[model samples]
Target: MSREFEIAREFEVDATPEQVWDAFTTGTGGWLWPMDAPEPREGGTGPFGSTVVTWDPPHRYTNRVANVEGIAEQTLNQLDYTIEPREGGRHAWVRYVHSGIFVEDWDNQYDGADKHTDFYLHTMREYLTHFAPRPVAFTTLDGPEASKAADALSTAVRGLGLAEDVPAGTTVEVRGPDKGLFPAVVDYHNPYFLGLRSDDALIRVFGRNHWGAPVGISVHDFAPGADAKADAAAWQRWLDEVFA
Candidate 1:
């Protein structure tokens, strides 16, 4: 039997409605992973081969997908984004909903998706408030099976030399593949996710083990001429070493 789920969130970003639309629509790598541009207007193509049901520019956008791959036992998936101007066009209030149906592993899948939305939205605010003008190169890597343990998140946190309950604004230095250190601030932190912001990048670490998945990391680079593949490779190597 399949069960339905809805994950709803409301937040405000220091950006206009137009800027919010661009962030959720065309500004792929800025807050989320990079992908093909969605076709504009109602009934047009949308993310993951979905159909755009509503397309009021700078206000509301929605899409529905039927029977997508990658997710197990998924039936129908829909995403809605409603934006409104706040502070007289300087900030935008956003309402987001991701609803879907899943079978058997409902609890695990729901846990994973529900928690991930917060981190992504937090990243969206970071992009709009800080790096909206810069182009982004994004990539993600999953840790090895060893990262599936109950304590995998703590392991990775310690591997990065961060405390289990680190606070926002704390600075941490992460070593790149070349052994050079890049300092980043703890922009957001919770039990299941870690967000870091640097001068030219945003880093998101997912503690997916709690939801029955391997840990993962996504890097959003805003530097000039950023390389996604190289960034992924470096992070993969780091995860391998961390779990080794």
Candidate 2:
């Protein structure tokens, strides 16, 4: 069935409004996955292939994509960001909206997008707080077929010494790719999403079993030695062992 949804969220980040503006226009890699640089003016193309609808530096930027492929019923996909400086410009308040018209696999597409948005935004705050301006090495990998099991996500979290009920802002220990163990904070958690942020990275474990798919993880590594392919392979090995 066709569905329309708007996800509106407001959060404070430990960054200036200018830094927040760069996060959307140029520095997305510091928070979200990297993308081609978008043109800076209205009528220019955005990094995600959307047309820039509005562009006002450090304040408002909106983009829209029309007639998405493979989704014949889709009409529009738009993203809007509004930033306001606060606390003497030491921090910023961000308002984000993702509104779209498309087909919905309510169990997966709609809900997954909603929850993943929270995790990504949480990562944005984490990045601005601890690792801003450092380019991150981001990589994503899918787990083995066994990861499709209902308990798959819970299993991995337990392996990290965390319960699904762990509250955010709590500190915990998690195994690193090379180091024996490293510290991370529970940045965000929900039934379908788990986010952990360490001194130099953000780790997101997605529970996609509900979508009839394998579980997956995305790492945003900002350490000086970060390498995307190498890091992804290392995590792939860990995921395989977790579900084996």
Candidate 3:
């Protein structure tokens, strides 16, 4: 017999419903975790080859995944997103639900998925609050490790001189592995995540473990005519040095 699992999370964002919808549909470079955009209709394909099941504008959307890349799977995964206006249309309320059926090891699988969900939601808030309507490009770089705990990754990221907690609108600067100084304002900060927004780019550093002990870093470049590939390469080099 196949077992089933489901998890739901809600977020309060300081943006309008229209703005949140655009981020889901168009401003994918600013969010969506660097994944490809899904078509605005039923049966559309999303990043990692997931299929869209629902696409309602500025209200609700859902996508389903049956086959996850590079993993042995015996279950189905479905992701649903809902958006509602708040404070007389000045702000928004968002909910994300992940539901599916699992054959075994349900606890571990669900835990991993739940942890990453928090980071992605944080990215969405960062984009809507400061970087919306800007031409943004996103790049994700992965470190070579496996099954890392959150506390361990946090220690490593903090040792690099990045702030553990920062208030919004604070000016800050940190040197990359190449000794290059990048400056930005603190858009959001948490125990395992850091979001920075600048005139030139939006930077997010995620110390949460994904698959193994690996730490993921994503950069969202908002500069006009910026080279996303080049920026990814530079950040990749920096990550390699720091995690080496």
Candidate 4:
């Protein structure tokens, strides 16, 4: 017996249920992958040939993906999200499951989607905690070496002799090619993703395997009165140097 490709992840966010719901439904601007979603009316057209399956505020929502713009024929991918309030509604727990079938190369497709799940969730947490309603400029750059292995990217990110993973409590100086040493904390870490929360930025490295494996670097800056374009360029230059 065989099973279709499916991925599920749970997240504990330090925000109210309402906040979390808004983050997922709004649009890419709200922390989800970059895509456009209309008002989310049932039976109405949605982004990428999707239909709103369920829309219960502050609780659960579902979307059925029939046609992903570029991808070939497939029955459908069900995207379901369930949110539960924790600690008397002070914080929330999020569960996201993306279930679908792949006709071929399941490993590569699953691997890419699994890692991306982490990246997007972390972005959501960052948005609810730091960036929020004040808009974020998300930029991503991919390279051949970056996507090959998670360990390799981890080694590069642990620059300046930092450990393979940042120390638990010790404040260590981490340096990037473009931006020298900056005070940052290792917010989340797993084999597929590394998230660093700096004073004014949220930096992440994703180990993804699209049809071809490629490493992805993303930066979300929340500096006061910041320039999105300039920030994106700086991060791109840094990626070049790191992967060079």
Winning candidate number (TM-score): 1
Number of the predicted model whose lDDT against the real structure is largest: 1
Candidate 2: residue pairs that collide: none
Q: How many residue pairs clash in each candidate?
A: 0, 0, 5, 3
Model 2: weakest 10-residue lDDT segment is 102-111
Off by over 4 Å in 2: 69-75, 177-179
TM-scores, each model vs. reference: 0.96, 0.90, 0.81, 0.82
Residue 123 accuracy (lDDT) in model 3: 71
Q: List the residue pairs that clash in candidate 3.
A: 145-213, 146-212, 146-213, 147-212, 147-213
Query: In what order do the candidates fall by TM-score, top score first?
Result: 1, 2, 4, 3
Cα lDDT tens digits, model 1, 120-207, are 8999999888899698898988999999999998888777767888888898886555455789898988889888899999988899
> What ranges in model 3 sit over 4 Å off?
1-3, 44-47, 102-105, 145-159, 163-170, 186-191, 209-211
Off by over 4 Å in 4: 1-3, 28-30, 72-75, 144-151, 158-161, 167-170, 177-179, 209-212
- Write the residue-wise lDDT of candidate 4 on 1-244 in tens digits: 2237779999899999998888887775545545666445656555677878887777988888754557653456878889999999999999999987665666766767777777777778877987677666666667546546545566556543467756434465768646677777777666666677777777776655334556676777667776667766776676666666
lDDT by residue for model 2 over 129-180, one digit each (tens)? 7887887898988999999999888987886777768988899988755435
- Quote the positional error of residue 141 for candidate 3 in Å: 1.0
lDDT value for model 1: 0.87
Worst lDDT run of 10 residues, candidate 3, spans: 146-155
lDDT of 3 by residue, 1-244 (tens): 4677888899889999999888876636777555677877899886577898998888998988885665564457788989999999999999989888766666666666676677678777877877787776778877655415546455444544565555667887767656777777776665556666777777777765633446777788888888878888887777666655
Order by lDDT, highest first: 1, 2, 3, 4
Better of 1 and 2 by TM-score: 1
